[model samples]
Each structure stands twice: as structure tokens, then as C-alpha cells.
Target: MKTLLMGTAVLAVTASTAFAAGHSVVRLGTEGAYPPYNYLDDAGEVAGFERELGDELCARAEMTCEWVTNDWDSIIPNLVSGNYDAIIAGMSITDEREEVVDFTQNYTPPSPSAYVAMSEDADIAGGVIAAQTGTIQAAHVAESGATLLEYPTPDETIAAVMSGEADAVMADKDFLIPLVEENSGMVFVGDDVPLGGGIGMAFRESDPEMREAFDSAIQTMKDDGTLNEMIVKWLGEDSPRF
Candidate 1:
């Protein structure tokens, strides 16, 4: 799970300059707290699956790009507000989100959302369940039989479960995997659920050309199998791919 801890001051300067056709400049916004997708590494730089994938897509699209870190809760609103050129975060494609922002073709397959608790004995059927607010996972929790507890960030959802404020937390399986592996106190339980279509880049509704550019670049990578290789490298062998 990822949390937002810093201000957007440095990220505000990412899209300050613009370039022409052969040297187009684009700013990519990401939540640098979700591991294997986009997260701040030990060097305090954005690193992981989306970082590698976004760089390759930029090269193929002939765009000079830079990364910008943002909190997950406000990521979409900031994109629509012109804070960045496109969102390269692992944003799932949904009709609700698509109504506000256009999305490129999916680069990653649909991901399975999972649940985990501090102990296997923890109640997951009808007890308090935690999830990040504004996400599809949170919506699902609200509709499920369990009592839903919303948090501003993904990290806080897990924190709630660990601190006994919540019985379990639901989130992307890829996100909970590494965390569960490292902490013996945590264990994944219950059947996994799939939500949304797949992960894609988001752009302002007026920027259809930007979406098409990235869509074409993603298609090129898929055709040559580069996309699949990178998916395995960062998301583990069992992760679904293009």
C-alpha cells in the first residue's frame, strides 16, 4: 500500500516547458507509493513497473517526458486541472473515471483485488473492512456485506487492519503480496475479486491526440512482446500480461 506524505511543489514544475513535434515534452503523473507499479525507491526517485513502461512508451512516441509524484486520492482531479500532461499511474479503466478523463488502450491486464488481515481468524464476511477512498475497491467494499471503513490512502487501510481498527483490508493483490510476505502478522484470506477493465494512462478529455499517441506506443510494445517481458519483471511471474 502507498501513502501521500509530501507536497506537490517539485511536481508542479514538471510540465512547465512545451516542445514541438519532433521534441514534444510531456509530464507523467504517478502515485509513487504503490510498489511494483510506481513507488519512491531508496534513492527518493520514482521507480518500478510504470516508470520503466512509461519511459519506453515516451521513447516510442517521441515525447520528452518527466515523472511527477502525486497522492492517489487527488491524482485524477489534478490531471484534469492541468497539473500534468498525462497520468501514468496504474489507474484502472472504469466508466465513471472515463466520463471525466480519456484513457489510452490498456497496457496491463485486469488485476485481481484481494483481502488480507492481521490473522486468519479475523472476520472478513461481515466485519469492518478497510479500503482507500475513491477507488473501485472502496466502492466494492461499500456494497459488500462487510462494514466499510474508508481511508485517504492505501497505506492507512493496512494500518487500520494492523491496529485493530479494521478486521481486514481490501486492495490490489499485487500490492498486498509483498507486504504479506514480509510481515508474518499479515495473511491474505477469502476469494480474490476483479474490478474495472485494466490499467491505462489518463488524459484531459480535450487531449484525444495524447491518448492516441500513447495507445499507439503501447500497441507497438505489445506486438513485439516487450510489454509482456516488463510485466513479468516487475509484477512477478503469475501476473497477467498483454
Candidate 2:
């Protein structure tokens, strides 16, 4: 009877351990350069809409969370290799990406994408716009017959525009509006274009539970005032949301 009781206790302990392992902490990755989405503030702390939303999701799911900053181009590859448990970098959910990793329900709806010229003299609507290679915006630029100066990240493309190296940059309207506002010479030209769909949290294809938790948290935030508050904070009053 004593041996049997010890055996049962061991099995219970093992079960508990397995359960704990199954619900391990989730690590979220982002490119710390895209403002209003994920970026380092003046104090060098990661703070933005995506960062705040990610924290909220982790809290709602009752999961320990850690944020990892990496280059934009490496985010998806790292996620595939298990370097990070998820990606929250304003990543658009498109069919091309679905071929590799699965995405949670879109938290941010699709907003129009646009181009901003750094110089008033620069004809953005007729000239080339710099875009990050392998992004949906790049594909749109390609379709427009405008020369696409491909870069590794949005920061690089923005830098090129600021330096007068590129005539303009094609990106989400929210990102460009703030940038153009801060730079007097910069202005968004041309009508906004629909790139694809909304931005969603991405996770490994096998992690259905984690994906579900994030999706539920995103929906909860959207239903409550949290998402609206964030949009107002980052995008200001006249911001568009679709």
C-alpha cells in the first residue's frame, strides 16, 4: 500500500510538471524601429502600440511574456526556427505569409497604405518610393510601375528619404503621417492604397493553443476600449481604422 501510494504521488507530480511545461512563457519578437507600431522611445525603452498591445495580450492570457527586438527581415525566420514564440510587429496577414507560419485573428484592421516625400520638390506620386523588400507594400509598389528601392527595413527606407537618397517611402498611412508631421518638408502624396489585409500576431504553425490565447486577447481588447485608446494615443484623432 505504501509503494502504491508513492507511485500515485509521483504520477501526480509528473502530470503537474507536464502541465507547467505546456503553458510555458511566451516570447514575442518585433523590429524596434517602426514607430507607432514598435519602436524605442527617446529614453531607449521599447514603447509603442504593438508593444503595449502585446503586453496586454500576455496579461489577459495569464502568461509570462518577454519581448525580443530583432531586425525586421529576420523576424519570420527566427519565429520559424523557434528563436521566438511569436511576432507582434505590425506584420500584415497575407496568403504568402500563411504558407510558412500561422497568424492569430487580426487585431488591427487593414488601413490604407501611402507614400510620403521628404522634399516638397520631390514628385512622390510620379517618382520611386523606397520599401522594404519582401513586404506587401513592396509588391504594391511593383504593381504601380514605380521604381522600388528595396531595403531591409522601414527605418532604412525612411532614412533614405530623409537623406534625399530616395524620393519617398511607401508604407502604412499611420506610420507615414506621423513622420511627415514631424518633418516639415515631408508630405504624403497620392491616394492611399489597400495593401492586403490587417496586421495579426504570428506564431509557429504547431502552437494552436498559444495562437488561440492571443486571438482571444486581441478580440477582447478590440471589444473593450483598450484598442481604441491605443489607436488614439499613437495615431491621433483623425486616424483611420478599417
- List candidate 1 segments past 4 Å from native: 1-23
Per-residue lDDT over 1-242 for candidate 2, one digit per residue giving the tens place of the 0 to 100 score: 89865664564344334434775577789888888898988887788998888888999988878888988877887776666678999899999999988999887778889888855566665577799887898888887777788999888899888888788889988888877878898887767888777899987776666788789998888888788788778777766543
Model 1 scores a TM of 0.90
The window of 10 residues in a row where model 2 has the poorest summed lDDT is: 11-20
Top TM-score model: 1
- List of clashing residue pairs for candidate 1: none
Compare the candidates by lDDT and give the number of the best one: 1
TM-score, each model?
A: 0.90, 0.86
Query: Alpha carbon lDDT of residue 1, candidate 2?
Result: 82
Tell me the tens digit of each residue's lDDT in model 1 across 98-145: 998889989999989999999888888899999998888889989989
Tell me how far the alpha carbon of residue 177 in candidate 2 is from the true structure, in angstroms, after superposition. Answer: 1.1
